[model samples]
Each structure stands twice: as structure tokens, then as C-alpha cells.
Target: MKFGIIGTGTVGTAIAVRLVEAGYQCLGVETRSARSYARFRQYLNRDRMPLESWVPEADLIFITTQDGMIGSAAKNLADRKLYKDGQIWIHCSGSQKAQILKEDPALPVKTLSMHPIQTFADVGEALKLLPGSHFGLEGEAVEEGIQIVWDLGGIPHRLDPEGKPLYHAGSVMASNYIVALADMAVQLFNLAGIPKEAALESLIPLMQGTLRNLEKVGLPQALTGPIARGDSEVVRSHLECIPLELQQAYRALGRSTLELAQAKMKLNGKEYPRQDLQILNYLLDGGKEKNNHGNCRENIRSKRNYC
Candidate 1:
């Protein structure tokens, strides 16, 4: 299929590069800046062209602009009668529904949302990381979008348009929050008088190891550390050592981790000492623990009615 990308940012360049490699025709790129044209010259077909001129040349038109611009751009395209009956209009927004492009249900163009759930640090990183990445797809040409993902050597996951917000939230927690957590880890290392260069070197391997464990064992089985073992003293020691804000954050995360710990214990036919469990939960919730921790271990293991 002939595909023209409207934006020439990381995603746009990456998609165009992969599509061209996958034997898809590149109609042309439509961009405002000469720098972007200069930047992604290898991927863009022909040259930078007017949006109107570019729209008609492709079977698929990808509006890879910023989130705020997507709706306006799609509306402008529809208003100008630039889209044809059978042309597919797609965007790579993780949070937006396909309707952002097909605002006018009367328009004959098939609309879609095809978002790659991967971080793009740079064009080079995007080019390398996109393959085997998972994409969230929705709307009229979902199958076609899935084919494009497969052509890129990526995995495709279907999504309901109404659930895009929650789906995006999960992606944000997984990707963006992990970055924030990494920053926090660096901050802790900094407090210990460690240089960022040294700290990052030490920390990245630990993070990568956790990821490897995640892929290898999956879920509760992948979870480790003091929380998994229900070691109340260790958690309390960690809380005392960290700053107040980190302590709060630790408590919040530990609350969630406790559930996973319970699951792990059940799966392994193991039980945590009730006193140790109670102390940890009390620490997590500021002296409040959930639903009779004194009996939680036996309740979880014997009856399987986990607290």
C-alpha cells in the first residue's frame, strides 16, 4: 500500500522508514519545516509537498502530528474534500480514539488509530526498537493496520475506542512512571554521594534484570524483594532511610505489591507469618491493615479466599 506520512517527527520518520523497507510505497511527506524534510530525507518519497497534493497520492494517509493537532488536521483534510471514499486515515496516538479523524461520520474515508506502545528516544532508537513492539489498534482499517504492524515485525493488540483512555493510562504507568521511578532511584544514589554516571551504571542492570524476570516468569512469579517475602523489618528499615515523600510512595506501591505477594504465596502453597504481614500492611496504610491480617495467611493458603 502507498502511505504518506504528514508529520516528520520520530514516529513519522520511523514509520516511513519501516514501511518503505516492508515494500510499501511512499507517496510523499507533507511537513512545515525544511529541517524535518532535511532530517527524514531518506524515508520520505519524492520530497516535501503540499498537504493537498500529498493526500491524493496515497492509499493510506498517516497524520502523525501532535495530539492537539490531530483533530484539527483531520477536520481540515475532510473540509478540503482531500480524502477519497476508500482512502484510509490513520493516526499513531495512544490515547485518542479513531473518531478524532472521522469526526464527520458522513465522510467516506476509513479512519483508524494505530499506536506503537514503545518509547522513541530518538529516530535511531525508534528505528531499532519498533520491531517486535506491540501496537494498540482500533477502528475501520484495524486489520490493515495490523498488517502494517506485522510488516514492521511488530505485534498488534486490538483496543476498543472507548477504552483508549484507560489503555493509555496503563501504558503511561508502565513506561513513563518507570522513568520517574528511575529518576527517584538516581536521586537516592545522589543522596549517598554517588555520581549519576556511576549510579546509572549500577542501577540499569538491576532494572534490566527485573525486566528479564518479568518476561521469564510473568506476574507475581516475577516479583521479588522484601515485599514478596513479607519481610516487615526490611520494609520498615527502607521507609526510615528514605525521605518522607519516598516513604509515602514506597507505602503506596507496597500496598499494591502486597496483593501480588498474596497471589505468589497462594501459587507456591506458601504462607507469610501473620504478625510480619500485619506490621507491613500497617506501615503501608499508616497503622491500618486490610481485613483481619491475623488470619490472612491461613485464609489465603487453606481456603484460597485471600484477603
Candidate 2:
């Protein structure tokens, strides 16, 4: 496909590199600065043309701008009457839907939203992480988008348009919140007299090993630690030691972890007695148990059984 990249940012540059390496023709790029334009020019080894000039020539165009600007860029293209029938317009937005590209339905162009599930710390990181990563896709041209993902050696997963918020929330939890979690870990390390500088170095192996476990056994089977063992005393002790600001987060995560632990027990054919799980739940939820024991019981029972 002859592709044109709009906005030569980290994502756009990484994608452009992949496209050219995969033997796709990058017609040109539209960038905000001379530096960005020059950078993409070297990567594409082609002229950096204006958006209106290139949009008409390419079979596929990537609006790889910020989530907020993607709609405006597409609308600008429509205003210039550049969209052509049968052309595909793609954006790597986790939050926005494909409809963002259809600023003018008169053009009959196809819009596709293909978001990488992995984080891109930079263009280099993006290139390294994008391959073998999963792409959350939502669009009319899903098959076309999937082919593009495959070309980049990424796995494509379809997403419902209505569930965009929830889907992106999963991404935020997985990618963005890891930093928050690392910060929390660093604070605890500091309490133990471990320097903040060394905290991540010490923790990285543990995190990597946990990730490997998840890949090897998948969820429920991969679960471990205090909640998995149905150890209420340990859980309570952790709640006591963790900082006050993190208490609610700890509890919320603990409640969900308990569910996973319950499933693990069932899957492994080692039943955790309901009373033991109940004790852990009571500790995690605190006053919620007092307020509505029946509702809490219903909530626990309503959770999926992995076995």
C-alpha cells in the first residue's frame, strides 16, 4: 500500500519505519515542524509534502496525531476535499472510534482505529515493543487493519466501538498504571532503606518473572501471593503497613485479586473453603460487609468460575 503519514511524532515515525521495512511505499508525510519533516524525510527517503498534496495520492493514510487532534486533522482533509473513495484512513487511537475519520461521509473513505496494546516510551521503544504486541482494532475496514497489523508482526484483536472507554481503560491499567505501581513499590523500598535508584532494578526481574508466568499459564493459573493462599492475617498486615493514601487502591485491587485467587483454587482442584475466602473479603472491604452482607455475597457469587 502507498501510505501517507500525518503528524510525524513518535508513533508516526515508528509506524513509518515499519511500513517501509515491510516493503510498503510511504508516499510522503505531513509534519508540524522542519525538524519533524526532516526526520520523516530521512526515514521515508521521500519528500515531506503537505497533507492535502499527499492525501490524494496514497491508497492508505495514517492520521497518527494526538487523540485530541485526529478528528481535526481528518476534518481538515475533508475540508480540502482530499479523501477519495476506497481509500483507507487509519489512526492509532485507543480512545477514539473509526468515526473520527468520517468528517465528510461524501468521500466514501474507510476509517480504521488500530491501537497498540503496548506502551511506546519513544520511537525506538515503539519499534521494539510494537511487534508481537496486540492491536485493539475497531473499524469498518477491520480486515484491512488486521492485515496491516500482521505486516508489522502484531496480533490484531477486534473491539466493539461502544466499549472503547473500557478497552482503553484496560490499556491505561496495564501500561500507564505500571508507573504508578512502580512508584508505590519504590516508596515501600524506601521504608526498607533501599534507595529509590535501586528499587526498580531490584523489582524489574520480579515484574518480568510475573509477566512470564502470565504468558505461560494465563490468568487464574498465574495468580499467587497472600490472597491466592487465602491468608487473611497477611492481607490484614499488608493493609496496616501500606500508606494511608494507598489504602483504598490496595483494597480495591485486593478484592479483584481475591476473585482471581478463587478461580485459581477451582482450576487447580484445591478448593479454598468459602469461610477462608470470606475472611479475606471482609478484611479487604471493611465496612461494606457491615452495610450489606447479602449484596456482597451476591457480588462474590456473581463472579465468573474459571474451572
Candidate 3:
């Protein structure tokens, strides 16, 4: 199949090169920046062509533009009548639905959103990470998208269009939040008198172990530490030592962890002692409304089988 790309950014260049290596014909790339096109040509070894020269001829076209520009790019191509009938148009925006490309009903093209569920720092990183990565597929051309992803050695998952935002949010939470979490851990280590330089280094193995656990055992089972152990005292000490602003995040995560802990306990045919569970809830809930025992019990009891 002949394929062309509209944006020659990191993702666009990577996809183009990989597709070519996988035996797809390159109709060439179209981009606004000279530097980006230069980089694309450096790896792709293909000519930079005008949109009119390639878009109508390619059987598949990827609009791998920045998330914000995808809609406008698709609209422009549709408006200029560059897309031919039955051609497949795709975007790699995690948060956008395929309908963004089908704004004109009479366009006669198949629209698809195929987002890689992996992070790429550059074209090289993207090329290395694209294979064996999962791609979220949504739109009228889902079957075609799956075939293309498989051809690129990627796993494809069909997703509900309405859930695209939530799906992207989960991806961001897993990718971006890991960095934020590491920073937070390093800060806490600094507060604990660990040298700033040594904080992240020390934390890396611990984080890696946790990731290994997740990979090996999966959720609830993989969860560990004070919250997972129902150690209300340890949690309370953490809140007391952690700065107030940081405590808000700690407490929020504690509550979520508490839910997982409860699930783990149930899975093991165990349960938290009533008082321990209540105290854990109270601490994680910020000890707010001290007199609202009924509210606390209702909330906890409603969500936990052990309660």
C-alpha cells in the first residue's frame, strides 16, 4: 500500500520510516517546516512532496500533526479535495476521535484514529518503541487500522470513540505521572536528609521493583507499602512529616490505594480490622469533619467487601 504523512515531527517521521521498511510505498512527506522535512528525509531517505502531489495518490495518509492541529489539518485536506474516495486517513492523537477527520459526510474517505500507547522522546526513540507497542484504534477504518498496526509489529486495541479522552488520560497518568512521582519521591528523600543527588538514584531501584511487581503480578496484587498493608500509623506519620501541600497529594493517593488494599485483602481471604480500616480512612480523608463518623463508615462500607 502507498502511504504518505502530512507532519514530519518525531511520530510522523518514525511511522513513515517504519512503514517503508515494512514494505509500504512512500508517496513522500508534507510538512510546514524545512528543518522537520530535512530530518524526515535524513531517516526516511524519501523526497519531500507537496500535499497535492501525494495526498490524492496515497492509499493511506497519516496526519501525525500535534494534537491541536490534527482537526484543522484534516479539514484543510478535505476542503482542498486532496483525499480520494476509499482512502484511509488516520491521526495519532490520543485524545481525538476518528470523527474529527470525517467533518464532511460526502468526503468518501475512511477516517481512523490510531494512537500509540507509548511515549517517544524523538524519532529514534519512536522507531525503537513503535514495535510491540499497543495502539488504540477507533473509527470507521478500524479493521484497516488493525492490519496496518500489525504490519508495523504493533498490538492493536479497538476502543470506544467516546472513551478516547479517558483512555488518553490513563496513558498520561501512567507516563507523565511516573516522572512527577519520581520528583515527589526525590523531594521527600531530600526532606529526610538524603542528599539531593542520591535521592533519585536510590529511588530508582525501588520504583523498578514496583514496576516488576506490576508486570509479574498485576494490580492490587502488585501494590505494597503502608497503605497496602493497612498500616494506618505509618500513613499518619507520613502525613505528619510531609508538607501540607504534599500531604494533599499523599492523602488523595492514599484513599485510592486504600481501595486497592481492600481488594487485595479480599482476594487473600483477609480483611482489615474495623478500627484500623476506619482510622486509615479518617487519616486519608484529611481528618476533616471529625464528627462525621457516619459519613466515613458509609463511604468505606459502600466500597469494600471486607467492611
Best by lDDT: 3
TM-score of every model?
0.90, 0.89, 0.92
Query: Ranking under lDDT, best-scoring first?
Result: 3, 1, 2
| lDDT, each prediction | 0.85, 0.82, 0.87
Q: TM-score: which is higher, 1 or 2?
A: 1
What is the lDDT for 140 in model 2? 82
Clashing pairs in 3: none
> Which ranking of candidates, highest TM-score first?
3, 1, 2
Listed per model in order, the count of residue pairs whose N, CA or C atoms clash below 3 Å is 0, 0, 0
Name the lDDT of candidate 1.
Answer: 0.85
After TM-score superposition, what is the CA distance of residue 190 in candidate 3 from its true location, in Å? 0.9
Q: On residues 78-108, what C-alpha lDDT tens digit does candidate 3 reach at each position?
A: 8898988899999999998999987887889
Superposed by TM-score, candidate 1 places the C-alpha of residue 292 at a distance from the truth, in angstroms, of 27
Clashes of 2: 0
Regions of candidate 3 where Cα sits further than 4 Å from its true position:
288-307
lDDT of 2 at 190: 61
